[model samples]
Target chain A: MPAPTAEQEQAIRDAVVRGFDDQVRFLQELVATPSRRTDEADAQRLMARAFEDAGLTVDWLYGRGAGDMKGGLVANLFAYKALRAAGLLPEGRVHLQSVPEEECTGNGTLSVMQHGYTADAVVISEPMGEALVRAHLGVIWFDVDITGTAAHAQEMSRGFNALDAAFALIVRLRELEQHWNEITVGDEHFGDQEHPINLNVGVLEAGEWPSSVFDRCHFSVRVVVPPSLGSQRAWEQIEQCVEEAREQDPVVSRGHATVSRSGFFSDRYVLQPGSEAEGLLRELFSDVAGRELEAFATPAYIDSRVYGNYQDVPSLVFGPVAESLHGKDERVNLESVKRCTEIYALYMARWCGVREG
Target chain B: MPAPTAEQEQAIRDAVVRGFDDQVRFLQELVATPSRRTDEADAQRLMARAFEDAGLTVDWLYGRGAGDMKGGLVANLFAYKALRAAGLLPEGRVHLQSVPEEECTGNGTLSVMQHGYTADAVVISEPMGEALVRAHLGVIWFDVDITGTAAHAQEMSRGFNALDAAFALIVRLRELEQHWNEITVGDEHFGDQEHPINLNVGVLEAGEWPSSVFDRCHFSVRVVVPPSLGSQRAWEQIEQCVEEAREQDPVVSRGHATVSRSGFFSDRYVLQPGSEAEGLLRELFSDVAGRELEAFATPAYIDSRVYGNYQDVPSLVFGPVAESLHGKDERVNLESVKRCTEIYALYMARWCGVREG
Candidate 1:
């Protein structure tokens, strides 16, 4: 697409500033909603209403959420047929690799805002920063149990210590650090070493008295792999590695540890630079930020991947650089919100194919 | 102390067995009261009441526990005063050691039981078999927390994974497991190749979000050490080892993991063999079992150590081997209880300076 004139850009900027004010209010309203995953109905409904209000066709569907355990909410916000005819919005879900956290995702109001914007390029005012933008990261989480016996310490010979066995796995996992790059589970190598598939071992409980023979212990684990890595595959690799380390355990023939699947997790979704969506978000974001910005390649994930996984619509994450989303003093800069709103509004105007002012 | 005549030995065995019955009931009742450190008030109150019921001249006492922590109880059981005056009972807290989980140690009751016997030779009734009648093991329970950051798998470059750090510690702990030794910790090898000082790494919890970073995880650790080993010394060793391991964690360099300690446990205690108590219990138990019996050296500890440590009362562990405690289908054979009660009653009568026909 040819670039808009300065006047046209300025006009878009004004609309964006206006959008910024509206988004600020919207964000406050969304923050008020308790839309955690546990309370899915409300979040889903709110997203549906938000998209509908933004003049988009709302499709509320359900799918396997955190595996066969929890159900997932799918609120599809597509360009209305009328808008699609004008080429104002894409026909399918914009497969985004960058889905912001819900509290910051804010009722998917940005979806509504994008729906409301009849444009050739739609922008979702996410909690991301106009400062950083980029590809994707995935998360892996699971649990492992160590089985052993318990007896009076004096009779420790009669029982295997579960906690010790579990700790062996823990120790093995730690050793993985040195060979992190050497042993690849998913992606060969991402640009960022810090963001590579890394393992996390958490949780453990074990004890004994004069009686018990042996018992079980648990460890919660998480790994961050590149977008190319599927959690199941990576988990398999990790489990095997743990097994391989057993013989090396200092406590010989104590017990065994087993790994299991976890219900809660999100995978990484990458918006490869070669993709049409990635280029578009970058160009548009560069113009707004008045500086070159890299893909928001922070080692985190957004909802964009789910969309990308389900639909073919290429999407890139573009928004304000968010701060402390789930931290003790989670907050965003007031100005960043305004900037993101302007950028999003401009994106929408252009994507809608609106003529220059 | 002179060797008892056959008739006198029978009377003492009867006293020991009878007293054992009373002690078992008391034990169940005391356990039901919950004497966990967390249940200080209730535990102290229950222990106090039991001591009074057992007819001990106990004085309730308190002290600063750990690091400015408060509230501790010390029960004085002069059960031996009567026997001691008669040149039978020994003076002291009947020291012993128990693996923490099996619910085996009966410090309060044993303290009082030592009272009536007032025998220079004291025997502790743990879940130890007749083989474990003389010695056992020692341990220190710990709750370890490993802290790390959770970043989206894609953006792990920016955060820490607590699970990873914990895994590293587990590995290190296993390495240290090589230091465990049966002769040192349990006084009996039990055919284990590793040191008897077993380390268990169990339990972990991190981020609620699948892809979200988990900041912290807690590991339940049970360290088995030689009854001859001081708990504080073992703990210091453990803490130092952990410190070194934390440094080895790559996360620590990346500003991710920071480890902490927990699980304030009692000291490890073991009683010396060939002491007056050991000889007496050995002679009495063998007579009751109707054959020559071997005193088992246990890897865990019991109250017999307490007696040896505080009151210089020579002691040995003598009791039934309750197969289940603090576990599924926990139970004790009624007949064993009755038989043990007779053994305990006999020990008491012989110490009471009573001679049977």
Candidate 2:
């Protein structure tokens, strides 16, 4: 495939610079609209309108998601518009997808693939700090329930304390996290990154009365399972870790512990290097940003696995710099958004063999 | 005081044996009525009715209390009736008092003393398994609040996990409990008892979301302070323990911790032996139960502290052989209740110098 002409490339860059303000406004409107899980209708309408205005046929995929992905979704529209503003039309086909459940289950994208929407290659704007995501770790969300006996505080020894057992078990699981972090044999992508596997004790609830020993405890945790260990084996290790705590730890030994998968049982995906999609994005990012493209693995979950792992397509994940995702004052840098839009426009143009519009 | 004559004793014993059915019925009525904290009006009505039926001049002490005290309250009314049934009248005035807040603040008893209800000696039925309470531990209830920054679990290091810090601090407090338990120098009453100082993590609540690092945690604990250590010094030790945790534990160092008293800041009290009250109860218990009276220190809070510690009265805490106090199916042995009723009648008859009717 031939690259876009210098004039067309210059036109695409200039159009992105001109459309940057509107792109930010679109993103602002998206952020203003509440799109938490199971409440995405209004935001979905905005996304469909944006995709249609960019001259792409929009398919209404149904599911639940949060608004953090709206920045990337808006960037996709402006990138497509940059191509059209440059008077270029791709000779090959392109599909614009706005998926929900990317923050939770990745089921929206799975539904799209199930609905027979297949592409030769894929590009996702995932807010990766202007860097390409070579791989992402799998996430396994689990809940632990521990039951003990409640006695008056005067005789706390007569009754086992569930919170004590819970903390002991959590300490043991942290050791498992450390052990996984130490294992570097199959960690080709995430080996250099320190502490890639995190065992986060996210929520804990225990007991009811303040005068009695705690009798019951329930806690939820998110564990990052390395791609090499896989989700099944990773869960087995977690179960084994809990079993060891139950058998060994004195406090945990006295209580009853039960574990269950709570959410996000998704596997990791690696965008294998040297694919045509990767070679094109590498060239385009370097050309557009005037620097060498950097690629690294992410320790978080991403929706690229729907295509890259399950659908056997080269799904490229590259996007703008984002700070505080799912946190306080979460935001995207508009300048990085513009640079990513230029690169995305040129990559599409080159991969699809653009002709004069 | 001279012992009740054999004929008077047999008549008093027979009255208690005969009225055991009515006494149990009165206790049942009290149990059926809901009297939790501020909801004590209905139960108070039943107590007043029983006192009136037993022919005692009752003073309505308005306050809140639980049904656990109803057994002892019923015992008091029935013992007075036993004296009347035995055709005996006390030469000295006896105040049959029922007050609330015994389970929590001890304020109800405090109000009684504040109302100028002074006595020669005091006797309280605290469901002590047929054993006389020589001393009882103090109870201090406190709440701990911890706050941390919430971040995406992938970058958990950027956020301090409050649950982690809370568990770490609890572990440190448990060590302080152990240290206090090991200090035998001042634990004279509880010297032979193992783990006399109990620190119970009663209620723990932390975090809201399952995928984000926990940002906040709030927990309530019940700590038993020995009589010798005193409530003031015990609280100081707890504060010092928390301060050490904040300064030494790495996880606790990053989060903010706040401690405040929630309830039950009462000091321990020892029933000083050699008092006229102790000599009478010991002889009566040995004669009524046909066994040498057993006395031991209790690691629990009792309302006797109100009169024993504050009012300078010999507050004797002895009651029926009750099992599961403040627990499921909480009940007192009826046969033991009969024995205790006989002893209480004899003690009041002998102490108040009963005259033949």
Candidate 3:
């Protein structure tokens, strides 16, 4: 497809500027809605309505998914709408897919792939501080349920504290995490990045009463595996770590700690440096952003894995600047949002080739 | 007061035998009732009905207090009923004080003392394997809330794990606990006991999501102070320990761990030996049990502290054999319950001076 002319580029920029205020308002309403896991029906309904308002066929489908995904999703919709408003439409078919559960599991996009939606390239708007993700680590969510003997604190020696066992097990896991991170120092894609793998002790619950030696403790951890290591191999190592703790560590030896997958057993994805899709996106992004596009490996999970890993297609993981992807006071930069919308519009015009509506 | 005649003693045994089945049933019903903290109204009502059936004025009242206190309360009621069944009554006035919150605050018994209830001697039926407690540890409950910077797990190096900080603090507290227990060696009452001071890490809660570095954690602990080291001093030492961890421990230094008293700030109680009350109890217990009364220090908290520590009266913390005072499947021995019922009956009749009804 030929690149969009200078006049068409100016029109795309103008359309994005015209809709910037509406885009910001839409993002504000979305951020205000409570879209916590399993309770995102209202947010999904709002998105469906927005898609219909954009004069697009609302394939009303439907966390951190809310954070990085919301701003990026809005940018996608507005970019598509901006093209139509600029009196243009893509000659080739383009499908705007909105899926959910990208935070805990990537099942939403995986389901979309299963429905056989093929494309020459795929784009995901995940907040990435205005850069493209060359590769991202996959995540494995697992819970460790530990059991120890319970006795009155008066006779504490008779009981083995489950909380203590869990803590010891966590220390062992951290050592494993450190080992994994150490190995990534010389990795091809992740090298030069400090501590590219993280094992997060996300949720912990232990004991019941204040005077009893805790008999049970449960903790969930999120561990990231680089694309070269693979998620399945990472899981095997995690299981072996706990098993060794049980057989060797005195505290864990006194108790039983079992590991089970809880969520997000996903494999890592990589977009190789050279591709026709990447070249076109790079040219379009430099024209709109007034800077060369930069790509780097992120030590976090993303939905682009569904296309790149499963469908073997070139998938671009791009997004606006965001703070706290999965934490309190999460926010996105409005300026980055506007720039990303313009870049997306330009890329779509050049990649698909604009035609008379 | 004259001792019971041989015939009266035989009648007391017969009266105890008659009410034995009902006492066991009452205990079973009480155990079956879910009398968890702040939910003991039903258990208290059941106790009130039992006292009424025994023809004593019901003093309706109120966990670990459950296992030892419930069985003992029923024994007290049945002992009074046995006296009436044996055609005898105490010439002196007897006050039946049934209080609550013994497991947590001991405030229930404290409230009774504040209500102007005074006695020459006190009897508590805490399950202690058919022995009397010479001295028991006081307990202080406190919670530690820890906060650290939060960041995405991909950027985990920028944030500290609050759960890790909590674990380090807990290790420091455990050292303090070990130091306290070590110093208790060669004490007067607790000299023979192994580890009379126990610090238990009970409840723990931390983190929110799996993909973010945990920023917050909260944990509650129960620490016991020997009768010699007052609760206030123990609390001071606990605060100092946490303060030291803040200054010295690297992990704990990265976060703010604030300590606050959650519940149970009570002084240790010692039932000094060779008192007239102890002499009478020893004689009565030997008469019925056909064995010498054994007394030793226990490393658990009890409600007897209210009378012995606050009222300066000889409070006898004694009871039947029990297993698991504050754990699952906690049980009191039925045979020991019968023997304790007989002993309580004889002690009350002799101490208060029985006469013709």
Candidate 4:
């Protein structure tokens, strides 16, 4: 396939520069309002308000009937053709005509089914960064628990030590990682790919007192699995690994130890390479930014997975450079955000096909 | 030694019965007050008042010099003529014109220098049925800490599970017991002796969060090194055992897996047997109660070791029997308490050379 024409690139830059100010303002507003994964209602409100203000009809999608979607942060927004009619949108002055609509459509999923317009293409406006417009990784989280026995410090020999028990499992768990390193031999779309596997044991609790004989403990875990290893495969491997770990526990002969199975999950994602949407978004971002855009895979996941997975939509991650979104002093570069908004507007106009569907 | 004549036996029995009545009132007063070892001031006051009231010459001794003594409890009580002169005691009771006064001596090394008393012969005067007395086994407390790594739960392979690490150590510690059981051949205290060893791991803690990787864990280990095995040998063995446990941790190769050293120092003691004092007390009780004087051993430790070690004072363990002293609804029967007091008084008088001491 041939690359984009010079004219197409210039138009993208013009549109992005024109739409810079309003786009940056919108991003700032979104980040200012916390949007934790589980804060579905509040997040929806923020997204709906912002999209509607940008001259698009906002449709919210709830995750109802979603079996055990505990860790998912959800709500969908569908903005239609009319957004381009404002002309100000493509030029990035989209915020000039926003009507303040106060009522909440509490039923997000149902509202999406009813109010969503039939468009050739869809955009999921999440906080996902523009950095990973092509390929993004999945997130996985789990909980581990270790239990021992309680005993008085003076008579340590009489009781089994839970802290020791927890440490034993943890050591083996680390060994497992090294073991995986020795065996994992390939790549995913994201990198030189021996599948980007990052594991973080973030939180920990063992004995209650500093000098106490701990009988139980709990720890939280987080991981970003790469697409090289299929999502389902990775999950199964982790669970199996935990079971195999139990076999190493010396205390198992006398009593049982608890290892938790829930809390946080990550799945890898691989967008089909050299797809139709890739060229389309590339032309738009390049034109808007007045520079060659380097497309990369996302480090974390976003709502784009919902569209890419469920509706078979060719969704790419793009938003304000969201580096500091969940942290203290969160900020987005004004130039990048404005460029992203203009690209979004141009994609809607070109990709949506101007026919009455 | 020949058996005593019938009149001598009858006289001894009558004297013990009389002593029992007076002792019941005394024991109730002493036991009713909460005299935990840590509550030294109150315990001292209660002791001093009781000793002086009993008409014994008193002298106070403090480990840190003297007279930080919050309570007026007599440190040492004696009925010797020289010590009691010049109206030293109340009512000249120390003179003992006919019926000699019994003096209760407070052990400075115990219930003073130490946190609590681990005695061979402790007359708590706590309400007990028939002034029950028995020998007690030695006790030791322990505190152990285990450290592990924190990583993403999904990447548990890469993370160190502190809980697991601690758990593993605990298991090793348990295994060490079995090793001890096997290797401790010809250990008369344990060889084929049921419950030759007792261990209790009492407390456990790790990360504060449920899903965190356990960074640090602590558990209390209560192992009773048999009086036969000895604390010196036990401590050496335990130190080596924990050191060996480091081999199981992954981080140990990278750095210290936080294999720490702590002293939950053991206060192992053995009962003093076949002493003149014990024989007299046993005889007195058996005569009064009309039953073979019962002797038994307990898992708990007492202050008898101080006397047996430092002063070479022969010691015996005797206290009121109760369901639980530290648990809920803790109370002793009034009658039992009274019996304990009388027994203590009779024994004290007899052992102190009553009028001669």
- TM-score: the better of candidates 3 and 4: 3
A9: Cα error in model 2, Å: 8.1
Per-residue lDDT value at A257 in model 2: 86
- Per-chain TM-score of chain A in candidate 4 equals 0.67
* Tens digit of per-residue lDDT, candidate 1, span A191-212: 5444255554433444433233
Quick one: ranking by DockQ, best first? 3, 2, 4, 1
- Backbone clash pairs for candidate 3 read B63-B66
Docking class of 1: incorrect
Interface RMSD of each: 5.5, 1.8, 1.3, 8.9
**What docking tier does model 3 reach?**
medium
Count of clashing pairs, candidate 3: 1
Predicted candidate 2 versus true structure: per-residue lDDT over A1-357, tens digit per residue: 556788888988898888777777677777777776687788788888877777531111111111246777877888888888878888888798987777666788999999999998999988788888889989998999998876667778777788878878888998999899888435788888878888888889997667777678999998898767888999999999999998888788877788999877888998888998898888888787889889888888888888988889998888877776666556677677778888888877888988888
Weakest ten-residue segment in model 4 chain A by summed lDDT = A65-74
How far does residue B134 in candidate 1 sit from its true spot (Å)?
4.0
Docking class of 4: incorrect
Better of 1 and 2 by TM-score: 2
Off by over 4 Å in 1: A1-36, A39-146, A150-158, A161-195, A199-214, A220-287, A292-300, A323-333, A350-357, B1-123, B131-145, B162-196, B199-210, B224-283, B324-333, B353-357
**What lDDT would candidate 3 get against the real structure?**
0.82
Give per-residue lDDT, candidate 3, residue B207.
82
Clashes of each: 136, 0, 1, 124
- The candidate maximizing lDDT is 3
- Which segments of model 2 are wrong by more than 4 Å? A1-70, A73-104, A111-121, A279-288, A329-331, A337-357, B1-104, B111-121, B283-287, B324-357
Residue-by-residue lDDT tens digits, candidate 3, B168-221 = 898899899888878888888787777778888888988877777888999988
TM-score of each: 0.63, 0.80, 0.94, 0.51
